[model samples]
Target: MSFKNDALAYHSEGRPGKIEVTLSKPCHTQQDLSYAYTPGVAEPCREIAKDPAAAAAYTAKSNLVAVITDGTAVLGLGNIGPLASKPVMEGKGVLFKRFADVDVFDLELATTDADAFIRTVEALEPTFGGINLEDIAAPDCFYIENELKKRLNIPVFHDDQHGTAVISGAALLNACEIQGKSVSDIQVVFSGAGSAAVSCARHYIRLGVTPENILMCDSKGLIYKGRADISGTYKEEFAQSTQARSLADALQGADLFAGLSTGGIVSGDMVRTMNERPIIFAMANPDPEITYEEACAAAPDCIMATGRSDYPNQVNNVLGFPFIFRGALDVGASAINEEMKVAATMALADLAKTGDVPEMVLNAYGCSSMKFGRDYIIPKPLDPRVLVEESYYVARAAVDSGVATRTIDDWDAYRRSLEDLAEGIQ
Candidate 1:
């Protein structure tokens, strides 16, 4: 059967969709039903009414995240609308459960208006521990996320923006070490100026890349100072004073090229124009700006990565979000702040350097060995260590940053619990 047919059959065979609500507690007996629905439920409701924070203890709100989307930007499909994006949102729920044991309720909103989306999500804070905004378009995504984060007490994360940023930031840390370059000194150029690109540019700066040394470009050439085209957009923050007006122009002597735009836009010649040992993350999905084969043919010394799993150093967001959220939710974090993000990145980078890839992970990828190098710059998504290590670091950071309401009394016990959780899933 064709791949397309197999996918459709898989989703349709057992259930109508990818996800369903399963009972974590028993309700088989008539007495259990009363406890689950009416009289017994009223006790917890009164407790929560007296103290709103009691909801976490009495209900599943602490472990529940809403994977909500406006569906204006569904993967490489683009603007498929809410109903069409259900499958993708449900897939996200599957990952959240399979990876971190987190519960997700996928919510697809039919409206695109930023204010309406924010208002709806804000009103849902009582039902969810976190809000995962997905697949919304760029500028509105920026606005919606900012407004929701400000209005809601729980962690509100846009996986499209920060997930890629965190994962790629980890890869960048390892790549710089192997290439014998300094993070503060490297000249980084971006191929897209959308949410992911803007977020990555900011994240790289936080990771030590100089803001002035970075150049960002959109569909209409480079974003330079005094450019009227990007006056009121998120791209304005990246606009710099430069003579470079095109991607090719920006690539000359550049140490890194981070592509988040459409595929087939970057060529081999453009790769060659970059500095020796240049790190090229041509991460446009389905197809990259430049293929791994073409990039190697152009610059044999360069470290190449893409969004595709067929290539090495794939910057998959699955490596970041699940574990990051697990930590945030465990700590009862008020927000997914910058410190927690950096902690996750650092954990991933450190994991790659351990040179102790688990046997199961190696077998899953059909490889005998994997280590930190030009090829394996980030941990594979299947590696069980990510759940324990990354989540620990993020949780620790949340406590140290003073954003966590609940604190872990014993660090060793917390880590062991995470390991147990990982083992249960495996």
Candidate 2:
């Protein structure tokens, strides 16, 4: 059968969708039903009413995240609307459950107005431990997320922006080591100026890439100083004062190329124009700006990564979000702040260097061995170790950063609990 038919059949075979709510407590008996409903349930309600923080203890709110979207940018399929984006949202729920044992309720809002979306999500804070905003288009995405973060106490994360930043930041750390280059000294070029690309440029700066040394380009051309086209957009933050005015012009002597634009926009000649051992992440979905085969053919020594699974060093966001949220939720974090994000990136980079790829991870990917190198720059999404490593670091950072409402007294026990969650899936 064709791939599309197989996917449709898979989603439709047992159920019409990819996710469902399962009971955490049994209600088989009449007595159990009473406890689950009216009288017994009222006890927890009374306690929560008396102390609003008691909701975390008496309900599932501590473990629940709402995967909310307006569907303006559903994967590579742009602006498909809310109803058409249900499958992707449900699939996101599946990943949250399967990977970190986190419960997700996918909410697709039918409105495109940023204020309306923010208001709706802000009103939902009582129901969720975190808000994961997904697939919303940029500029508006930037506004919505900022407003939501300011208004909501719980962690509000836009996976499209920071997820790519965190994962790629880890890969950049490792790639810099292998190439013997300093991030602060490297010349970086970006092929897209949307949410992910702009966020990545910001994150790489936090990871030590100099802001002035970076060049960013959107669909028009290079985002240079005094570029009239990007006056009020998020791209304004990245506008540089440079003579380089095109993607190819930006690539000359560049040490790193990060592409979040459409496919086939980068060429072999562009790769050759970069400095020796250039690190390239052509991360457009379905197709990259430059294919892995073509990238290697252009610069044999270049460290390459993409958004595809078939290649080594795939910068999959799954490696970050599941574990990052697990940690944030575990600690009752008030926000997914910059400290926690930096901690997650450091954990992933450190994990790759440990060279302790589990046998199961290798078997899952049909490989005999894996280690930190030019090819293995980031931890695989299936490596299981990421759950404990990244989560632990993020939790620790949350507590240290003074954003956590709850604290873990015993670190070892907390790690074991995370390990149990990982083991459950494996």
Candidate 3:
């Protein structure tokens, strides 16, 4: 059968969905049922009621994350509604389990209203260790995450924004290193002005990319200071006081080009105008701003990456979120802060620089060679080192940044803990 039919059959054939709940403890006998429901369960319940933090110990809340979404922006599918978005959310839960052994309960909210969405998620704080905001549209997504983060003590992450930022930031660091270009010195042009674009600019700024050196372009020409239609907090934040009116104008002499916009928006002519060894991340999913073939033909000197796996350097978000949340949840972190994200990004960059590709990773990608160069600027998603190293760095950052409620005094033991988690042990 074809892919579409196969996917429909896979989800509908057996369980009717991708995820289900299984008993952690058996309840086959009368004694087990009494302990599970009436008396023994009440003991943990009363303990949790006496001390709220006891919930983390007596319940499954510590390792649980809610993959919450309103389905406003269902990736390439685009606003397919909550029911249609369930499969994707379940897929995300699968990644969380497969990568970090973190438990997930995928929650798809039917309301598209930002206030309703925020309130719904806030009410769910008791059930999950963290809230992962997914596939919500741009401005609303921003509003929801900000309000939720302030209202709830748990980590609130809009994966659409920060996930891309973290993974792309890692790729950007490696690309800059290979090209011998300093972050502060480079003129970066972004070909989109939505959540990912604005968030990336903010993240790059935190990573040492100069704000004034960056230019963001939307459907309208450049997001310049005097643009009439400019609105929203993030758009205003990235607005530049520049004379460059178009993407092509901004690309001239630019050292980096980041495309989070629609596919095929960038032409070969635009790539030709960039500075020597320019880094281009044409990260539109299923397609890119410029095709890999066209980009090579345009500027052979350019180091390029895309969102497609078929390409050499694919900037995938799977390289992030799972490990990030793993570290955050493991440390009992109050929030996923900038320091933690930077640690993850730098860890990724450092890992790639080591040029140590595991045989399993190579076999997974079906590649004979994987080294630190133009072709391999970031680590593969299946690399087990990401769980140990990235989560280790993130957990350490959380502790140092004062966001962690729990402490890890033994570094060696902490590494072992992460190793155990990666091995699917609690």
Candidate 4:
């Protein structure tokens, strides 16, 4: 069957959707029903009323995330709107549950008005422990996340903005190691200045990349100083005072080319102009700025990755989000701070270098031999070790960074708990 038919059938089969709400507690007897609803529920509600923080202890709020979207930019299908984006949202929830065992409520907002969307999500703060903002278009997404982070005590994460940043950042760290290059000295060129692009650029900076050495290009051209169309705070932040006016000009001798733009935009010739042993992450989904074959044919020595499973090095965000939130929510983190993000990235990069690919992961990828090198810069999505490594480091960072409300006193037991969670997922 075709993919479209398969997808439709898969979603329509059995329960008619990808997810369902099932009670965690038993309700077999009449007494159980009464305790589950009226008397027992009321006691927890009364306790939560007396102390707001008790809600985390008595309810599902501690482990719940809201996968929210206005659907202005649903994956590669841009501006599909909210009602049409339910499947995507539900699928996101599935990832959250399947990967980290975290419960999710997929929330698709009906309106695109940023103010209305922000207010609506803000009101939902009491219901969820964290917010996973998905598929909202840029600039507005930046604004909404910033405002929500300030107003809401719970962690607010824009997966489009930070998920790509964390995953790609990990890959870049490993690639730089293989190439014997320093992020501080490398000249980086970005193909798109959207939410992911700008966020990744900033993330790179946090990971020791020099700001002035980076060049970001939007649809118009290279984002340079004095550009009339520079719209938002993030655009202005990356705007460079340089002689280069286009991607081609900026890419000459560049150490990295991060493509968060459209497919097939970077030709083989463009790849050939980069520095020796260049790192090219052509990460546009479904397709890329340059195909793996095309990039390899051009710059034979270049380390490459794309947002594709078929590719050798796939920059999948699945490696980051579920675990990041898992760590945050476990520790009752107020926000996913920069330290926590960097910790997760470093954990992923470190995990790859350990050369301890689980047999299950190897089998899932249909590979007999895989290790930290040019093609295997990041862990596979099914690598259950990620649940332990990424989440552990992120939670520890939250504690050290003063964002966590709860702390893990016994490191060994905490690791065991994470391992159990991973085993359950597997």
Model 2 worst lDDT window (10 residues): 227-236
Off by over 4 Å in 2: none
- For residue 212, give model 4's deviation from the true position in Å: 0.4
Better of 1 and 3 by lDDT: 1
Give one digit per residue, the lDDT tens place, for model 1 in 1-426: 999999999999977998888898998999999999988899999999999888889999999999999999999999999999999999999999999999999999999899999999999999999999999998899999999988999999999999999999999999999999999999999999999999999999999999999999999999999999889777888999999999999999999999999999989998888999999999999999999999999999999999999889999999988999999999999999999999999999999998689999999999999977989999999999999999999999999999998999999999999999998998
Residue 207, candidate 2: Cα error in Å is 0.7
Every model's TM-score: 0.99, 0.99, 0.97, 0.98
Which lDDT values do the candidates have, in the order given?
A: 0.95, 0.94, 0.90, 0.93
Candidate 4, pairs of clashing residues: none
Pairs clashing within candidate 2: none
Better of 2 and 3 by TM-score: 2
Model 3 CA lDDT for position 236: 78
Q: After superposition, how far is residue 396 of candidate 1 from its true place, in Å?
A: 0.9
When 3 and 4 are scored with lDDT, the better candidate is: 4
The total of clashing pairs for model 1 equals 0
